[model samples]
Target chain A: MIAELFAGVSTRARVLLVLLAVVMLAAPLVLDRYLVSVLILVCLAAYTGQAWNILLGFAGLLSLGHALYLGLAAYISAGLYVHFGIGPWLGVFPAVAVCVAVAALLGWLAFRFRIEGVYFALLTIAFAEVARIGFDHIGFTGGAGGFFLPVRSEDQGQWWNLRSGPTFFYYLALLLAAGAFLLCAVLRRSRLGHRWLAVREDPEAAQALGIHINRARMSALLLSAGMTGIAGVFQAFYANNLFPSQIFDISRSIDLILAPIIGGVGTLFGPILGAFVLAPLGEVLISITGAIGLNAPGTKALVFGLFLMAIIAGVPTGLWPRLASLLRLRSVGR
Target chain B: MTLSLYLEVLLQGILTGLVYGLMALGLSVIFGVVRVVNFAHGEFAVLAMYAAFVLFTALHVDPILAAIPVAALFFVIGWLLQRFVVQPFIVRPQHDQFILLVGLAIVLVNALLMIFGPDSRHTNLSYSYDSWFIGPIIVDKVRAYAAAAAVVVSAALFAFFRFTLLGTAIRACADNLTGAAVVGLDVKKLYALTFGLGLACAGAAGAIMVALTDVTPMLAPSFTLLAFTIVIVGGLGSMAGALLGGLLIGVVEALASILVEPSMKSMVSFALLVGVLAFRPQGLVGKPA
Candidate 1:
């Protein structure tokens, strides 16, 4: 299946992909632990960005509250593990299920009311804010005080429990990123993907052409939410702590969308390339700020803001398309 | 609980909501004229609050007095932002514009955080504890002043749009952009002026809010959300609706905090926003799109 997916790729692109895969597979062995962890973050961001790209880039449903799914999934999986002794391997199922259900409800409310464009985005934000405040008050998920996962020293290498070190997480994240990439590639070429493109380009036109606009949008939301839920499970186990304020903040939602946007929205490699550029750049910015004795907590975000503006103003299509064109490579999964 | 307590809360909500309406007024004006949402509307307000705080701390200037300079300063900043940053992307996709404004918000917020630290700051006014008693009701002096100032500013804004030629031109552009352009109206200058006026309102609102609440970089996002909620509930682009929505939200939140809990205030407002969006997408006073 993987080989078939890659069959349409040109020779140069195929070679680049093969080399990239090999390097990623062997990265943990050569890179320092800190760098490996950064790679894990890149992978996690890529996974989430890809998920977000489906809804926004493909289906033209701009959601400013994607953290709703990510936070809910994290809390659900963490709660299951903390209370019921359910491993993340099992917890992920329920997490994704709940997120999909939420996406269904949100999509229904939005589409039913004919709330299009910016209003739809605002509605998403409202839902996320409601969830954040509701979680802050709810005692079950530790409320504003935060939720924590116990790190059993004995379960050091337990993959099922997600109680492993950086290497394990790095590999898991890489696998997820790669899987999402393939999934996105396949979906982009599928009938549903075409329907999404049609709806995104012109909703009324698509509807007139006999496409189920609501169903297409709903599918995008559900698929995106479900994928993002897995990333949330990864976040819970990797961080071992959850705070409603941090996880469910609009910033988190913004963070998820940035990579896809900066890399090139609606492209297969955009999220991955964006994550690769952004996560490490963020780490480097932190180090530079530390070295320069600028102990300001807002420096990274400030730079990110400037960077986003530059990208939008300079190359609105994002870096991926620019880089691809500069490199003279035929765009894949367009 | 008691009727008098409810009345007090109602009054408080109305007073606070008036200021909230003022904060949202800029957003409504900008959207009405330029067809662009200033996502950094709250950050601009926060910046004004910091300016007012600085004026108070450094020169011992009263925030009420400092509001004029702050509003004037913010008007220039808004005009510059619209000309240099926002103007280029005015014709871009809505998503692109959203990203551009969101980026500006992040930059403004983080810059404030770096400069001021994360600590909450407030003016140490002599009349901070002053209040007025009317029969069985107690009105906080600061809130009354802030509300009065808001009313004055809003009245001025209304009069400008109603009576001034430039305001009429801006309204004409809002009414028909192509028609305004065909008639030789410098649409771009008018847009920048509209944006400037909008941020000026935010600046004034922020200056007044310093007396009621602590100023912090963290408050930016919530303020933005609150402005959005107000505009949506009041009906986007409707000046009267913005004020009314602000009062309605302020009252609801005040009553919610007293009746339920303080943290649930945002939840109630969001619920109101969602309810309004679901039932009346055009808002209470806004004409149907």
Candidate 2:
């Protein structure tokens, strides 16, 4: 499917893609442990960004509470692993299923009531806030004290337990990101994708044309939530700690969408490019701040905010589209 | 809870809620006139709170007395923001505008974080520890002062919109944008003015609120959400509704904290918001779209 999708790509672009793949595959081998960890974050962000792009970029549904799904998946999967002795690989299925169900319920409530635009966004935030508060009060998941996943020295090389070294996690994250990218490419060309575009561009017109607006939006939400849940599982094992206040924060949700928004929403490669640009840039800024003897805690966030504004004001289409156009590459999956 | 306790909590809620109403009134005004939801509404309020805090800590100025200068300063800030940051995007899609304001919100919040650090700060007014007893109920002196100041500011705002020519012009713009333009109203300038007025309300509310609670950069987003809940419950674009919604939310939160748990107060507020959204999206007093 990926080959078929890439068949029409220009020779230059194909070469670029292959080169990029080789570089990513070879990254952990040469880079330091810290840089490899950063790459893993970039890949994880790319995966989540692609997941979010499906709803916001493709279907025009602005959800400001996507962290709800991520946090839920993290808690559920980690809880299962911690208590039931189930591995993340097995626990992931239930996590994704729960997320999808939640998305279905949320989507039904929203579409049934004809909540659109900012109201819909606010509804998402409200749901996330409710979940955050609920989670904070629930002692089973450690509440505000935070949930932890026990780490054993003997599980160093266990891929099944997802307790391997940073290199293993990096590869795992890369696979997830690459898989998500290909999935998005294929989905963007599918009938549902076309419907999403149609609905996003003009919902009234799409409805007139016999499109199932609610169904399309619901499917997008389900898919996005499910995909994001997988990332959550990865995060559970990677971070080894989950706090309701931090995981379910609105700021976390904002972080998920920033890559897609900055990379060029609705584009297949935008999330990947955006993740690559943002994660490293953020690391660089953090290091710079540390080196300058600055004790400020929010300088990174401040820079990100300024960057978001600059992107919105100057390149509303985002960086990927402009860069692609500059290289004279044919618009892919448009 | 006992009846007197409930009444006391209700009175306290009403007092705090009045300030909340004033805060949301700014949001309602901007949304009504400029047709833009100030996503940074809470950040502006937090900035005002910081302003008042700085004044009080530095010059020993009372927060109540500091409200005026803070409001005036925020008015100019809001006006400039509308002109420079928001004006260009007025014709863009709603999503773009939302992102723009979200970005602005992020900037303002982190700026506060950088300036004030993460610790929560509050005014140490001399009368902060004092309380007033009226019959069977007790009122904190700070709460009474803040609530009284809120009432005064809200009344002045209402009078401005009612009696002043510029206020009428702004109202006319909100009523009919094209018509106001056709009638020789400088729509752009009016929008900036309305934004300024809205932020002024937020500033005053923030300044007054410093005496009631602590201020921190992290409080900004919650404040924004709280203001949003109030405005929505009261009905978007409705001035009176903002105040009404604030009072309702404040009372509900107080009741929940007392009846249930303090942590569950937000849960109840969100539940209320969801109920209102599900049943009455137009809000209690707002006209149906």
Candidate 3:
């Protein structure tokens, strides 16, 4: 089944896949520890971007509230770890369930009232803010102070799943990114994907074609929320901390959308490509400028601003779709 | 809190809301005429506040008196911005351009942040410290002036939209841009003028804000979010809706803070946005179809 699935992928995608796999396998051996951390960041960002794209790009649902999922998941896992002495691996279920429940409530409100377009975007943002405020007041989630995960037993040699090294985190992130990519790929070929695309193009037309537009949109939203929730869990485990102010921030939501949007909204590789180009560029700019005794402030926001402008001015079609066409990866539509 | 203290807080809230409403009017005007969100609208208001600050420090001019020239200058800048940056994308996919405009806002914010560090500054008009005692309410002089200014300016805008030839042309564009174009209206000129008018409102609001409250570069985000909530509550394209919506939001936010906590005031507005969006998407005073 896996080989057949692989066989159906385009030649360029397959080649790129092979190249990525090779790189992932060889990165720890070849790259410096610092570079490995950077790559791990790229993976995490790519994962978040991809998860975000599943809703905004494919379903035509612009959710500026995704930080709620990230923040909630982080809090859930971190709280469990701090309070119960539960391991991160075992705490994934409750975190995911809570995120899904929150997303479902939001989705219910949104879909029931038919809050389409920019209104939907604003609604999502409002919900996220509410979550932030709620978390701030709620003592269980550490309130305004935030909660941090206790570090596991410090043993570089132990591989009993609580791995702590940069290499271990990098590998874990790589695996997660790979899973996200594969899931997106599978979803693109699924019935739901076609339905989502149809609704995305024109809801009335899709409804005329007997597709349940709302159902499709809601499903996409839930899946996207769940994926981002997992990313939050991963983030908490990696960073071992969760702050309400930082987690449920509007700026964080903007960051999630920026990468996928700058690369390509709907394309599978857009998030990864965007993360690869933008994340390290931001880090390098900050480090280089800091080294010269002048720290570049707002470096990430500035670069994203410029990137968004360039995409608007120079390439109206996102970088990934345009590049994909040039490389003959696939046609514009499935 | 005492009942009198509660009344005092509510009155203050109403005054604060009037200022908020004034700020939102500029955003509504621009959004009504141009379909663009004007992500840089709050930054322009902040810049105007800075301009007022300069007027206070340099020429020792009153912020209110300085508002006229600031409004005129910003009108021209806003007009030019529409003519150049916004007009081209009037017919195109505005998502990327909207992001670009947000970029412009960030640049403006950081530039101001760099020039004027994060220190908060407010113009201290000597008489502004005085208060008026009416029945059980003690309204501060500066806040009262801000509310009074909001009423006068909003009423003037209302009259302009309702009566003037140029205002009618702008309203025509707001009602239907393509239809106005088809009717041989100078759609481009009207758009620029509308944008200018919007920025003028922002300038006026900023002048009032400086007189009444502190100013800072960090004020952009809070002001932006507050304006968004007002716009959502007021209805996107309706001038009358903005005025009514502003007062309503202001009162609700004040009462919420009294009943709840101080931090919940923002939550109140956000909750209003969400509730209005879910229940009455057309907004409180939106024109009936």
Candidate 4:
């Protein structure tokens, strides 16, 4: 199946793919630290957005609370690290376990009772809020004051447990994102992928065809949560800080979902393209405005809001698909 | 704890719940007709609160009295928002509409943040902290007034819906837009009006909240969430259901605070929301989906 899939790739697509790989591989070495950091952010956003895509884009579950998984991973790992002298390297294990467990629990409750559509979205939001509020009040996790890891500037040269310079973080994010993209790509070709698409398109019809709707939703949710948990671990160490409000915020959830929604839903490359387009642009907008001493309170948010509004109003189907059709590219998506 | 303490908490919770009903009324009415969740509901409320604050500090009007202008102003704003922004994409997919609303919410919030900065502003009315003592149960004057005003408004709105021709037209649109249009009722106009009416509810609630809490752009999501909880629990398209749900949520919140830490209050409120969705997705009063 993998060979056939690759064999189906057009020559032009392969050339572009090769060129893309070369650029990505050499980017860290050639680019400035700031650009490298931005690239890392773009990759991280792509990874997180891909995770969300499995649910909302592929399996048709619009979870507005995906930050719950991120929060779970960050808070659990951060809490364990701070309280027990463990590193996030070791912390990812427990975080993944708990994150998957919570995802399963939420998925079961939502899917088992067939609470779906916008209600499912609402349920996810409620759960995410529950996690945020719970974490904010726990004094052992530093409550609302914030929990920080002791990463000194001189720790840049180290690489044993993800302690390194900005370049190292960039590579790690790139690898993680590439791995996630591959996993999702493989999953999209597997039998499970076909079932997921069926369920997403029409649940009743899928059920009539003997697809277990609950199981399908659960697996997508669990897969999505596991991926999100990994991203959380990466972020926990990368940012070296874990504030409950920062991690579990609704806006944080929005940031993750926005990439896929804006790029294109149900497509493999949409999230990556979206991350590349949005994350750097957003950070750049903020920095550019700040450098000018504009001191505007929500310049970044204003840009994002306008961008999102324009996208929704103009290209509700999202950019990737529209661009794909306009460029006459092989429809490279599920 | 003691009987009197429980009574006080219960009464306070009920009053606060009524205010929640008022806040969610606009959301409920909008959902009933438009079938889109107005994510900007909370921001609209916050803006109304700011307007009320301006009225109190700049014009010497009472906060309660400021509710009238706030409501009026929000009605127009809501109408324009629905017509220009929301109407364009109302025919799109539900997810797309959600995105639109969420984007609008971001725009509204950041716009406020840019204009007002991050500081929360509140009116310092002469009776801000004044309370009425009634035999071991002390009631906040602001709370009582807010509750009374909310009840009167809700009651009047309820009667209007029940008897008025325009009100019935709106309900008909909610119940069956295509049929309403077939019957020659202006469905689009009714939609704008319903959305306006809903925003008016949010504005009135905002004015009442000026005496209860500070106005901040950051408070938007919580207000939206609170309204969601009330509207969902009450069931969409049911105003009385919203009031009952709001009261129930208020009592639960109060009890949770008394039983646990105040910080744990949201933990209880959201848990209750999850429980309700799990058990009754259509809500206590909503027709089954």
lDDT of 1 by residue, B1-289 (tens): 3888899999999999999999999999999899998889999999999999999999988887788899999999989989998999889989889889999999999999999999999788989899999888999999999899999999999999999999999999999999999999999999999999999999999998998899999999899999999999999999999999999999999999999999889999999998898788899999887
Candidate 2 C-alpha error for residue B141, in Å = 1.8
Q: Residue by residue across A198-239, what tens digits does model 3's lDDT show?
A: 998889999999998889998999899888988888788778
Is model 4 an incorrect, acceptable, medium or high docking prediction? medium
Candidate 3, residue A14: lDDT: 79
Residue B54 error for model 1, in Å? 0.3
Return the clash pairs for model 2, or none. Answer: none
Measured against the true two-chain complex, the DockQ scores of the candidates, in the order shown, are 0.80, 0.75, 0.50, 0.71
lDDT of each: 0.92, 0.92, 0.81, 0.85
Candidate 1, B274: how far from true, in Å?
Answer: 0.7
Q: In model 4, how large is the Cα lDDT of residue A185?
A: 83
Model 4: residues with Cα > 4 Å off, grouped in runs: A152-158, A295-297, A332-334
TM-score of 4: 0.96
Model 4 agreement with the true structure over A139-199: per-residue lDDT tens digits: 8878789888777768666675567888888888888888877888888888999899999
| Error at B24, model 4, angstroms | 1.1
Stretches of candidate 1 above 4 Å error? A1-4
Q: Over the stretch A1-93, how does candidate 2's per-residue lDDT look in tens digits? A: 667897778988888889999999999889999999999989999999999999989999988899999999999999999899899999999
lDDT of 3 at B187: 86
Structural similarity to truth (TM-score) of each candidate: 0.98, 0.98, 0.94, 0.96
Whole-structure CA lDDT of model 1: 0.92
